[model samples]
Target: MEELINSAKALNAKKLVVLCRLEPGCLGPDGIDHIDAFCQVAERALVNFNADICHWCLAPRLDKSLIEIQYSLAGKVLSRDKAIKFISSFEQDLDVIEERFEDKLTQLINQYIARKR
Candidate 1:
């Protein structure tokens, strides 16, 4: 768990998305306990390193013994341009799922940034 925190800090993660797999024997009972605990770890490290953007995602519905974890770090500025702001903080990603899937995410992203500046 400590290692996970260090990795995020090292990567300069601005946005984090985690995917958990639910299968038998993936984790022990303690692993279940650590889900909430890990959040504390992230918050503390963010404070230590002065991180500006940090978020977490866990398995939607799964028990502890079957869990998969993922951590990602993004150091890029999140643009809020109207045309390409596919994921808004105000709404859930599901709201734009079809639109997001149909569109070329990277293209919208790049064009948005270019126009923003």
Candidate 2:
């Protein structure tokens, strides 16, 4: 995860969206627990980095959707004098369900970049 974040920073990315997946036995009994643990990991890795970047995590197994993990305008490198925003107003605002998973991811990335700018 740290490597991925560093890579994004290296590429001058202003935002990052992570789709987290855990092996069956390695995760907690429920999705919320998994999300909590993932947040802990992200915090540790993100603190030392000094860049204006926002990140959102999506974990279907944890019952987290794209709309639920909107970015908060709280970064040093990528702050644009605006508040955090989601890719779409909400999941219902998206027609991504008709697209392939890869296409949906592409849309999310595009939306994030567009909204952040």
Candidate 3:
């Protein structure tokens, strides 16, 4: 989880989305408990990092196979297609994401400079 946070930082990510396989009852009576514990760890790590990044966890429902997106820090549920798109984007290129982030920062900085001038 620390590795994940570090990776996100390295990539200059404004947000981090984690995808995990979650079969509630399949793992037995303690499955959901374990999942909850794991999510808690992720939440704590994100909070402790104290960055301006948002953290989300995407877990698939075994019964329906639908994606469940949750805010890691707030435990709020979010979207499905967007979650899949986020995962796909990550799988495509980490370097590209970093480059895009840098580009956006540069653009914002340029805007600020222009406003000041």
Q: Give all candidates' CA lDDT scores.
A: 0.38, 0.38, 0.44
TM-score of every model?
0.22, 0.25, 0.28
* Model 2: lDDT to the true structure: 0.38
The parts of candidate 1 lying over 4 Å away from their true place are 1-29, 48-117
Which residue pairs show backbone clashes in model 3?
none
Q: Which candidate ranks first by TM-score, i.e. highest?
A: 3
Question: What tens digits encode model 2's per-residue C-alpha lDDT throughout 1-117?
Answer: 999988866654444333333322233344343445544554444333322333434343433232332333224322212322332333221124213333544454444335435
lDDT of each residue in 4-94, candidate 3, tens digit only: 9888666544354434344554334555644454444434544423133434342435555554334222233436445445545546443
Question: How does model 1 fare in lDDT?
Answer: 0.38
